[model samples]
Target: MNPRNRNILIAAIVVIVVVVAGIIGVTSHKKSSANSKTVNIGIMTSTKQDDAIWKVVSKTAKDKYGITLKFTHFTDYTQPNKALQNGSIDLDAFQHYAFLNEWNQANKTDLVSIGDTMISPIHIYSSKYKDVKDIPDNATVAVPNDASNESRALYVLKSAGLIKLDVSGDALATPKDVTENPKHLVIKELDAAQTARALDSVAASVVNFNYATAAKLPENQSIYAEPINKDSAQWINLIAAKKSEKNNKIYKEVVKAYETAATKKAIKEQYPTGGELPAWGLKLK
Candidate 1:
């Protein structure tokens, strides 16, 4: 063979070998990646912006444990658990013990709490009155009409000296349950989601913290907010998974990633008042 022709043939062979080796390396990396686990979880936050913490949590979980996280966001409270139960997602990080307990009883599902999140308290806000005492005796106060928060709002009002309940310390008090109206106060019932926006129409309205964030109501404007530790364990929000997944290692890492200080700050920044008390360090008992 001619010397130049032989040299050209050798170069072609070397090129083919290099290309095949590169393809094998790429294929191996993809196979290794595909072998790792990815977790899909649902969260019902106030809005998409409030879903920011999942980004940080996802990054950390992926880096530390070769885990991939897919977050499904929900603005509605009733949807997360349904999505979880139907296998739309593997887990969810929404609702507290009381809400979950009620949901499980009503739906006959065995969902359970895996870990705690922060407690976002219910608050009463007044556009007209700064001090609860300064309000007119008969001033209309708005409360959430839903059974759960209506009771909570009444207790908040009772604690503020605004009204007296038939059961003074009842956690499930309703308007009819008000035994005494010293000021002849008319309790206006509105949808739970609307209570924050109804401030201009009523003397004051009790707002859920999530709805308060949605309405952009500053926490400073609150006439009263439920104290963090004062509230029962029923009020403590949590990360939930199927009772079947209680021992899931990946799901546990997802909770660990979310409970970090960085994720706590992320939760706080989503609200105007820097958010509620962190329940990360709290025990289940």
Candidate 2:
């Protein structure tokens, strides 16, 4: 073998090695970029406000972390968690801790909350009476038939001095726990979505903010609305995902976006009377 030919062969081998290494590097980088790209989120509804919030989050995610975000809104609460559990959604932001807990317990799923979003204050509205004291003895009060919100209604009634509950601490309380009914408030449990409409028939009703908002009955119009500082286990609305996805980068970014000043400002502006207070905490303690 001649010296020139040997040298050319060695140079050719080096070039080939470099080219292969470059190809491998490029492939790996592309895969990494693809994996770290857009995050798909599931929300309750695809309204204008939800789109606006998603835009803010998408911008933040892209600007801060070079990630894009997509939002998917479900019309019902049951499907979002089911979607999360089934790995259809990366995360969800429409439910409170109580609903999540109840679903988890009932379905034996491992969905967990990653961060707090905003508290949807429950309100007790009445047309026949101005306050709790005005209700006649044994007055029928309509409450959401759902477990969590029904429990919340009972707590509100207890708070209003209409009933005495046997439960202690800030855990979820049910109607069965009512030890004393000074007003003899007959709890006429109705579907949560229907509680707002029941206001016309019942003496008073405990209404969720969403239904209340839908009914055009803001919190200010209610006879009583839950206060901001009340941490009575019912106020902890949260951002949730499957347990396996809890610590993902996208989840953290979503949490950051949710906790941002802009998000809080939007919440206050959007739901001033509904008492949509912030809850930055995610983990249960």
Candidate 3:
């Protein structure tokens, strides 16, 4: 109880208090850091079907992968790529190889595919006629205006025997490539997303799968549907990221999250009623 002993005891108590405070601060910081990291993904269209798939993927990412994945919805097929290029999103999942190649050439950006998603076949649907042969001569037909989709539309039309595309034209075929239009059909190029609406006005229109589903077209009942197979490799959909993030471990995991058999089931189930088919893409570990 003397003055020297009393001062020593007080100094010891102050040091203990400071040490305890430092420990608490460190523990709190660690907890905050462990919560997880956030990542944003860009997608073409937001639908209840996609929402279901996202719900499962988002929960799995947070619980098992320590990533908080958020999706930014876009109406235009062209928007997702631009968003990825400008760094507005961490990644995007709304394009195929042909479209990717065309965009890269057209825009001077270096986006690359991280993984594959699905192949939704493009088909020509006719609300006015029961068959392609029934289409009147000189009738107007609508096709997606985007270079990749336009070429696809042309292929479908050629397959119908209404026109003949020169062998050299192939996937790059344009309206001018038509060497013989037996029906003299008019090819009206419109935005890919608008082709379905154009069906009501044109004799027939080539519609992309997602847009067809969105427009509620009868794809299963369409007059002509593109066959799904290895031959359609160029139309296979993919998950894309900036060229710089191709090898990033975290982004790689995000890409793998969609490769699960369960995710594939969810994707296919989305179109149970019609308009789209799921292309379970490559499983890249």
Candidate 4:
């Protein structure tokens, strides 16, 4: 063979080798990705209730995003964030922006919101009074004692025309912030879970929607509910991950799964009577 022909042959062999190598690399990448498809998420609610919404989300993630969602259930509000911080779970979806802020400030952790989920509105429920107007002076009104929730409950009271607050809408207001109580309302604070239970004893109690659902609080008993207005944006529920994973592609896909039409339908069905409103892309004004 001539030198020129020999050189051409070598060049052809090099081209075939590079093409074959590229195909193998692509196949290997797919396999590696498939192995990492399953992601574990932490939740602090009853699995039965969440399953209604997450069943749709999980199915969507699997079908459309090639991801599998597994849940790690915690019994209380405090555990999921701790679990996420410790790398025990890949994500958490049981908190609003205010609650997350409170937790992050207290724990000094850098968890950040990656997606909005829903607004679990807090309402003043009364077993005795037919309306907020009917509740007399010196009536005891129970509110959640937690920093964020206490502030939200006060805002709800202000909305009801039962009290006046001195703090800004976003401030973590307390009983001291109650600048005026025209009804001379007694602001009793209790655990968020116990607020619903307090309705029987107190004139009224500000109850988180989840606790109200768990307590089976009657719809008509809710005399006043906080508006889902611009100020309520901080109360919008969200999915949170570690700051390091805030921009993670798989995490973003999980958010996409939760924001689908099917998930919205499931949320409505699961939380009949508007206990939980889907908040993704909600234009609060």
Candidate 5:
């Protein structure tokens, strides 16, 4: 072959090699992007109640977002938050805002709320009396020992006129803030999970709805239950994730599943009479 012809053939081969390399690079990039989009969600427990809700989330994620959900359940509250902070999980949905805020503030972590979930109303259950006023003056009452829940128990007591708190507006009231006790009620603080059992010992006890339900306490039998339409800031449960995952597509899909009509139907069928009200937003009405 002539020298010019040989040089042209060499150049054509180089151009072909460059085109093949570009196609391979584009294909690799597409696969990498797709792999990075799968979402890993962490829940607190695999309890029967939670499993019911998660089924909806899982189905919605597969059908709507074309994303696979890797669901994990922590046995306790601490591990899920730690896992989320360390990037082990992308999102978590087993705690209320009060618990999340308390944990984040104490640990100095940057967990944020992406959306609200359901509100499990804490009820004041009485074994000895028919109503709040029926309890004798100076009788003992049981409340949760944790800071956030303790404050909520105190507020419930204040609402029932068993104690008076120096709270302005709708602020949370604490034991130290108790301004007056016309009944001089003896307050016995116990672990939140243990409060339901304290009913046999104390005049009455403030119990979180989950524990109450687990203990088989009938919802209609409670002496006092939080109103579903109160719009109280303290009532909203949240979907929490690291600040980095706030706008993630899979995280948004989980929130959407939580607020779907199917979720509302599940909640209503499971908790008729507003025992566990849907709280996806601030306005309950």
Candidate 6:
């Protein structure tokens, strides 16, 4: 073969190799990108405040697991779980085990917890009285009316030594379950959101952490706080979804992204008053 013809043939082969290599590289890049997707999460938060912890977790999810966190807020407590069940959202982070069980029993939905989130300890707040023991007899004290929270509030009152419950074990105790009210205090049941507002009129009100925070109530002023323990284990917050999707890989990844050191730090920083505490195998300070 002539020298010019040999050189042309070599150049043509090089160009074809470069084109084939470019196509393969593009295809691989696209496939990797496809692994990344968005996950919609329903959150029932009282405050519209910017969530710093979620921001950190979301960044980690995107950078590491290729999942983007999209949060949808709801004012009503009953909405998130229902939304998750009906396929309106991918997952939800709100209710604790007790609350979830009550919801499941009532609605006949079998949503399962995917991972532990944080336990927002229930608190008894009083503007009029400095201590639980200071409240006068027959004084009105408000508590959340929802089945799960109402029972939890009653237990908190019992823990404060003001009341006694007739039931034991996992059975939720209500105001009627109060075998003894030494003070004969009037237990006024109100919506969880209204408990904070009723603080002015009532001797003391049992308020959820989120509702207390939303009302800008000082945490230090709380007369009594429910201790986190074996009894309160059911109150530990968690991420939940339809029971059928309990073992989904991407959902598991989302949980891993959230239950991290970074997210834990953010929770502490965001809730300096310790109203919210991480529940996933972390020691409480």
Candidate with maximal lDDT: 4
**What clash pairs does model 4 have?**
none
Q: Sort every candidate by TM-score, greatest first.
A: 4, 5, 2, 6, 3, 1
Please state the error at residue 150 of candidate 6 in Å. 0.5
Residue 254 of model 6: what lDDT? 95
Clashing pairs in 6: none
By summed lDDT, the worst window of 10 consecutive residues in model 3 runs over 276-285
Worst lDDT run of 10 residues, candidate 2, spans: 276-285
Assess candidate 4 and give its lDDT: 0.89
Give all TM-scores, in the order shown.
0.77, 0.84, 0.80, 0.87, 0.85, 0.84
Candidate 5 lDDT over residue span 47-107, tens digit each:
5756776677678767877767788778776798898899888887778767777887899
Q: How much does candidate 2 score in TM-score?
A: 0.84
lDDT of 4 at 174: 85
**lDDT tens digits by residue: candidate 2, 53-154:** 557667777777777777777898788888878878788778887788888889999888888777767888987778767789877999988888887888
- 141-218: candidate 4 lDDT, tens digit per residue: 999999999988988999889988898645688898888899898899899989988877899999988788889888
Full-model lDDT for every candidate: 0.80, 0.77, 0.80, 0.89, 0.79, 0.88
The clash number for model 2 is 0
Clash number for candidate 6: 0
Off by over 4 Å in 2: 1-35, 168-171, 218-220, 229-231, 281-285
Which is the better candidate, 1 or 6, if ranked by TM-score?
A: 6
Query: Which candidate model has the greater lDDT, 2 or 6?
Result: 6
* Ranked by lDDT, top first: 4, 6, 3, 1, 5, 2
RMSD of each: 6.7, 3.8, 4.0, 5.3, 3.3, 5.1
User: lDDT per residue, candidate 3, 125-187, as tens digits?
Assistant: 898888888889999999999788888788778777788887472356688888999887889
User: Per-residue lDDT tens digits of candidate 6, residues 1-285?
Assistant: 999999999999999999999999999999878776889999976343237778888998998898989999998888999899999999999889999998888999999999998988889999988899999999999999988899989889988999988977677778778899889999998988899999889899999987887798986669898987766787888999899999999999999998999888888888787778889984443
